[model samples]
Target: MGPSITDVPKSVLQDVIIKLPTKSIIMCKSVCKTWYSLISDPAFAKLHFAQAEAYPMVRPVDRRSVSRNLYLVEPEDSSGFDLKDHDCNRSRVHMNLSKYKLPVCHPEELLNYHRNGIVMPSHETERKVSMKITQIDDNNNEVDLGDGFAFMMQYDHNSYNLVNSCNGLLCLSYFFGNRPAAVCNPITGEFINLPHGPKHEKAMTLIGSGLGFSPRTNEYKVMRILKEQTPDTNKVAEIHTLGTGSWKSVGTARCSDSELSFPTCVKGMLYWFCDKWSGCSVISFDLDTEEFQSVPSLPFEDGYDVSMGDLGGSLCLCKVESFEINVWVMNDSGPQKLWMKKISIHTGFSRSWPRGVYIPMKYFENDGLLMFNSRLNAFFYHHPGNHSPFIYLKLREIKYSSSEAISHVPSFISLKDILVGKDVEILNINSRCAVLKLPGETEALSLVEENASF
Candidate 1:
């Protein structure tokens, strides 16, 4: 028998809600009037929300493959976790490209040939191209899941310019001369254009732009910061929220003389290292409340400043001095704890932290890898490994530094190529791809054999 409401302890009731998933807790309110009242209370809701925040979701690391060559050479056991006495040594794997009918290219040569930081356009065109996302098996061959399925925005031949990709969506800023800037999801091809605000003569002076999703209200927001030229010498800031279709002034923009960097969204908040007109401060924007708050100033000695980076799903402040690099993870509220750990003090290009490099705007590859361009070197940081020591995978080398004009390159590969091995009794292709499985089928051999011909 259930205990009476008067006999049940409030602490026990709070524990029950806290242990349940956020979705389940909301559904519990429908069970009874007392349960509804308890769950509907703002204070109780806030408490549960806080608990959820405390336990941020951690994705399981796929122990399948690590590198391209490794995946091909030994498709199975590619995780490298089973390799005993595997120290932090930079080791290269050898593979015969010709074995898998792959192009005969040296690992280093292939790495140098490709242009690194280019955002693959979401739009489709005559020549379709696809990039490898995850190595499903260790065969060293890619399971090219059609270009659009993995991309965040619709593939547009024209109109789409990738600024940067963060989390799952890409931060795209369109330049139609006098047209307003538009942010979009490359995978789903959904986009929201920012509204034109007070016209400024010098829009070129703008330094940073960013987009973030608020799960609480299911809304996406974009923020832009521009350095204004005037006798007053004060920075200006503007923000735009999708569906509203108008730019709203936030506050006096404050940023350093150095190129302004975009805000980093961490733990449901947008944080920016800014030099406010009054003084330099780390400003944080709360997505839930849409309010701005200031963080404690960074402690630096001898005028040395620290740059911010994302560390293990948290906002990190990085300090580099000669050969030593220190990464500090922010723990604003906890057991009065702030974790300051040293990632490496090694000497070489390998020691350079790629996550700290600022890209205009970028999206997080489906697997949480960051793709960006710095000078001639295209850089990628795959987050499958330890977050601090970001694996700096080179994408491509830039041949020319011409005008930064936007161009679209579509994937030539068909959607049919991606669904090769997966079991599909009923395959439906329309605007989006869907697969239906048949009962009593242990495996789908015919589909795998047909795709193998490709």
Candidate 2:
């Protein structure tokens, strides 16, 4: 045999390990103590997270489902595309949320419980909601979570209506700020519940919310735009850091009263569309300095439904006309000329087409496919020159009404590592469906191979 891996130099070994994906890195930990020490380093986690590719996390658009499951969208050949059936082309890796029960706490109920100050769930009862997660392949066959892989969560939210994914953590909350938000790593099953913000004196309308990470400070922040129903109809912003447990006023939000759209976080900036007297312009907020700036305005005409998304790390604007959809990508430049129309999909008002504004979700770089979602259905479009340019793939609607998809990158960083001294609930589920309380530093990952082949 050749030289052993242990014979390699420390510097060379690290360079190779950091380049591997998160699942493989975890497996390397059990190989030996040296590998474990290297992979477990906090610095290595950050480096690996920065290099990981993002995948789309698809879920039910309608939040009425009693049991919501997270789906990983994978692309297949055009042969699976069917005009009659919507669930033929794509395969999903289901992360079942039905097994775990979310602790229900509405905003009003939590306010009343604050008379004696809100108390966290006791440690003895924290293990009540342990759950087992299984992976289903493209052939619809059930498989184990994987070797040395497990998933668990100690949930503490009523509903996951408002979801903002950044880095490797998901910011889950109820729409209109009806409940406290929880920052959770679905892959690791570790979560921290944020304290509710101060109650506003005047009635406030939630315009939009975003979760972003600041690499400069190595901190994650949540920003909320609330429009006070006052005479001026002015908008103000509030920000909450992960471990702070309180929100501070962040001055005014510069945006007019357009229809509310979900914000997208790219790099360290959060962007959303806002109506202007001239037309509609994109507004961006920097997570590091906590400053807001206006991006170059779009050149499109008014009176069309618009949405924002991140395509290949650049800001993409999706405009939906009567039946056609145009996806424009903007290079990070100072002028407006950098914005170019990337994908133009013309789906005539056919009988099979869902009649609603389509929102551009994610763009598959290697496959040259762009995915769009609407209130009623979801469609995947391959750029010109590919077989079957326009294909519709609707999610199986057994229990849920509609579905929504967003891009998410999984990270191996533990919440306890970031929020030191804070009490984080750890839930562990093995391949046998056994529930146990693992140590804080323990890692449990479920591997799902992402395929976007033609």
Candidate 3:
């Protein structure tokens, strides 16, 4: 070698390191003190996060208590993370389950089995789905792990629910607003508590909430929807800026439901599934302009269970019909072709549509796989083709009533800087390793058991 990497200039090294994937950058922190200091700098994190891509993020619930652990799924090929703007019309699947047959099981039976911490024998018949999970406990201030691992951050003593994900930051709120909500960077463990929404005289109830980032102003904002107990059942929306430390009245909401569907943030706008007297439609809110608009709804008339999500920077809806699922997407190009059919997945199991079905979460283009979760609190990757195979990833032994994984990009954007003088607590995530064996895999992968916090 002509010269060592250490001999490289600081500016050149920083430039090269920032281009690597988030997992590679995290490993760079251990090279030496100089590299650690350079990588840990706030400026470097901001620059690197800008270039990062969002991946499937899951927080496995621990029935004993709340969990603060986060899992980031990375594909074998880094380019597989590029779910947006790809030209591949077909995909090649990795897990070989051509001979494997999916067992016929209903959603109710799966849910009941999961509730009792029992794994159905049918789910164990095939080992087509597999992932390598590693658990690491870091004494350092930052969370550092090798490939195919998760990011960790500490949370408070109470339990919190993940409202939505925006620009690498997760919006967390207490169940039914028992306590204030917060926005946090799970990687850095820096967060700021938000004040409750504007108080109202007419008994108000929390309906919905979400967090988003404003690209125009470079600010993070939180929104809350409250329904007043009046004859008309009026609803009001409020906005809260991070650094400003206060809430502002936006306007009346058009939704009439006491509890609206979960919201998804895509490209700085928030979208929610709204039920109207006419039919089902999607409502969108702009973080920059502070305006709400109605987007097109699904084509079906009724009796289909649907879940809305942000798939590859576009608004995606997945509806279940018997054993088949329809994936529809709203293109951002123009108004002429608003919603169109993207893909159709046949589960291959001949059974009646259960209470809960497969809901598309995120897509991996290079891998030709679509990642989604079922109401049974498990995640599966679907590869659309003649045979339509699915690979399942196990999150731990924790039992949950329902589970969902959001498209989240891991970043180091600090809340301390975003909130300036506000109280931002830096936390330490507790970590431990467990064992999980797949149906046919030779080697077993480690599972992550993380402590609770938001």
User: What lDDT tens digits, residue by residue, belong to model 2 across residues 206-274?
Assistant: 677777878778778888787877777878788887777678888888888654465778878888777
Q: In angstroms, how far off is 83's CA in candidate 3?
A: 14
Q: Which lDDT values do the candidates have, in the order given?
A: 0.39, 0.59, 0.59
Q: Given candidate 3, what's the lDDT at residue 4?
A: 75
Please list the Cα RMSD from the true structure of every candidate, rounded to 1 decimal place: 17.7, 12.1, 13.1
Error of 2 at 89 (Å): 13
What ordering of candidates by TM-score runs from best to worst?
3, 2, 1
RMSD of 1: 17.7
Maximum-TM-score candidate:
3
Candidate 1 regions with alpha-carbon error over 4 angstroms: 1-166, 174-180, 199-207, 254-258, 274-281, 301-307, 335-339, 348-393, 396-454
TM-score of each: 0.44, 0.67, 0.71
**Candidate 3's residue-wise lDDT over 1-454, tens digit each?**
6887688899999988887656666678898888999988998888887776666666544323234445566543444432232243223322211110111112233344456665423222332212222211111122233332311111112246777888878788764242236677766645556664554667666777888777888788888887766677877888888877568989988776746665888777888776555567677889999988666656776524778777777878878777677788888787553788887867656553234645565665543545555454555555554232544444544444334566777787667666634554433221111121112222122223221111
What is the overall TM-score of model 3 with all chains considered together? 0.71
Show pairs that collide, candidate 2. 86-394
Question: Residue 376's C-alpha lDDT in candidate 1?
Answer: 19
Local error of candidate 2 at 379, Å? 4.0
